[model samples]
Every structure is written in C-alpha cells, then in structure tokens.
Target: MGTLYYGDAASPIEIEDRALAHVKVVIATKLRRGESFTLSWAHGEGQEPGRSTVWLHPSIPLRFAFTEAEPALLSRAWIEELATSANSSGGLMIVPEPERGGETGPR
Candidate 1:
C-alpha cells in the first residue's frame, strides 16, 4: 500500500503511485517555472486536518517514498474546481495546461 495524506479535513488528498508518469509531467513543469503552492488532504474519518506547502523545483525527483514530498499536480478537473474556489475568495493561481496538440513543448 502507498501513503495517503489528507488536507485540513479527515479525507485523503494525496496518494502514491509507481505509475505516476502523467502526474509527474505536470508537476515537473510547474516546478520548473518556480511555483509554490499548498496541497491539503484529510486525515482520518474527516476528523483530523492535514496540510502541506509544496515548494516546486526542478531538482526534486519524482518518486514515491514513505514521507511527504512536494505536492503533486492535480487533475484538470481538480484544477478547475480549485480555480472556482479561488475566484470566490477573490484570488487565484494560474496554472498552465499541458500542450495537447502533439507538439513538443516545455517540460
């Protein structure tokens, strides 16, 4: 089993996977651009709160360990949801999307 971390709630927010190629791609790109953000996960049955600030960088290797690492990139759907929530709070972070035209783009 892999490690799972929760946000400020008692729900899991992070999961480890050996097959995290796509996720690593997105996260690497963001880190290359020097972006910092926070990722939260719920701990326990929605009773404990957990959170982590991800300091993205190119030097960080993409691997699954027994401890907390930098925050992983969220799925497109999650990103959209976060954007919406940020808007409601009168603030937001703009995360660029991966190129989809089958063209070689910055990694």
Candidate 2:
C-alpha cells in the first residue's frame, strides 16, 4: 500500500502502489499546467464503506509515498483513461487498472 499526503491532512489517504503511480503522473501533469481538479476514490478494505474526494491544486502541498523503493511500471492505457476522467466535469475518479497482456473491452 501507498500513502498520499495532500495538504496538511492529519490522515493520509491509502492507495495501492500501482494505482498511485498512475495517479501521480496525471496529477503532476495537470498541476504543471496550472490546472486544478478533484480526485475521488472508493474506500478500500479495512476502512469505512464510502468514498472520498480531494481538490488538487498547484498551490497545495502533495506527496506520494510508496513502500517499494522504486516506482512501479506504469500503464499507458490506464494513464489515458485516468487523464480522460481528469478532464471530465466530474473530475478524476480512480478506476481499477486494466488487465495486462489481454484484450480489454470498451471503456
């Protein structure tokens, strides 16, 4: 698991390392372009059964912490999907990573 520290929130958001890597890429790209958006995800196991959303802005302090020393391999297709959501009116909603080395159905 990985931790996403956004702003000065007392509790960091926990996300799987692979998914977090993809999210990091999209977020950095948007922030670099001075764009702000919302990032939302359904709570995983061991947490309350609900969802959470955060406003991401360039001015806010953000950090990604992974248990592994090195970064995970990123998926271009998944990144594109996330980017598409980021550009949507509803903002970015974290979706499961696509299966590797297999044909995926339409989004």
Candidate 3:
C-alpha cells in the first residue's frame, strides 16, 4: 500500500493500472519543464486536510507505487467526467496541455 502524504496528513490512495498512465504523463511533463506544484484534496469532511507539494523530476519512473489512484480516467466518458470534476474542484495541479491551432496561454 503506497502512501500519499498531503499537508500534515497521510492516506493510502489505491492506484489501478490504467490510471497510472495519466499520472505519469502529468507528472513527467511538469518535471520535464522544471516546474513544481502542489496537489491538494480533501479526504473527508473534517480531516486534518490533505496536500502535497511534489517536486517532480525527470528520472522518476512511471510506476504504480509512485502514482495516485484517480479512477476518473477509466474511459473516454470518465475522462470527460474527470475534466469537469477537476475544473469544479478548483482545478488540479497538473501541467497544462499545450494550446493548438494558434491558441495562446495554457489550457
């Protein structure tokens, strides 16, 4: 059981095989560009709070143990669901996908 330490609290987040891919892509992109950020989530109603300032690095392997369980990406529909959830959840700390077709700024 891998542990996700957030803020001053810690919990074990279950990561399935599929979700690991998205996590790897997100983390790798941020680390590759020498960016650092925080991932925060409220585990329960009034827990001690949860957050982690991950210092992503390129050498980090895309392994299950290093990723968090975000089951929202199980399918295309789920991906769209997650996108909506992320936007509503104050936006997650992820490397923004590059703009396309002359679009400017981060997506």
Best by lDDT: 2
Which residue runs does candidate 1 get wrong by more than 4 Å?
1-26, 44-49, 64-75, 82-107
Q: State TM-scores per candidate.
A: 0.32, 0.92, 0.35
Sort by TM-score, best first.
2, 3, 1
Residue-level lDDT for 79 in candidate 2: 86
lDDT of 3 by residue, 2-98 (tens): 3333333334444334443444444445556865443433343344576433333345433335443443233433334334433443443433233
Root-mean-square deviation of every model: 9.2, 4.5, 9.8
Candidate 1, 13-106: lDDT as tens digits = 3444421323344444455676533333334354456534343334543443334344433355534444453334322323334433333322
Per-model lDDT: 0.39, 0.89, 0.40
Candidate 1 achieves a global lDDT of 0.39
**Per-residue lDDT for 89 in model 3?**
35
Model 1 residue 77 distance off true place after TM-score fit, in angstroms: 2.4
TM-score-wise, the better of 1 and 2 is 2
Q: After superposition, how far is residue 67 of candidate 2 from its true place, in Å?
A: 0.6
TM-score of model number 1: 0.32
On a 0 to 100 scale, what is the lDDT of residue 14 in model 3? Answer: 40
* Range of the 10 consecutive residues with the lowest summed lDDT in candidate 3: 98-107
The candidate, 2 or 3, that scores higher on TM-score is 2
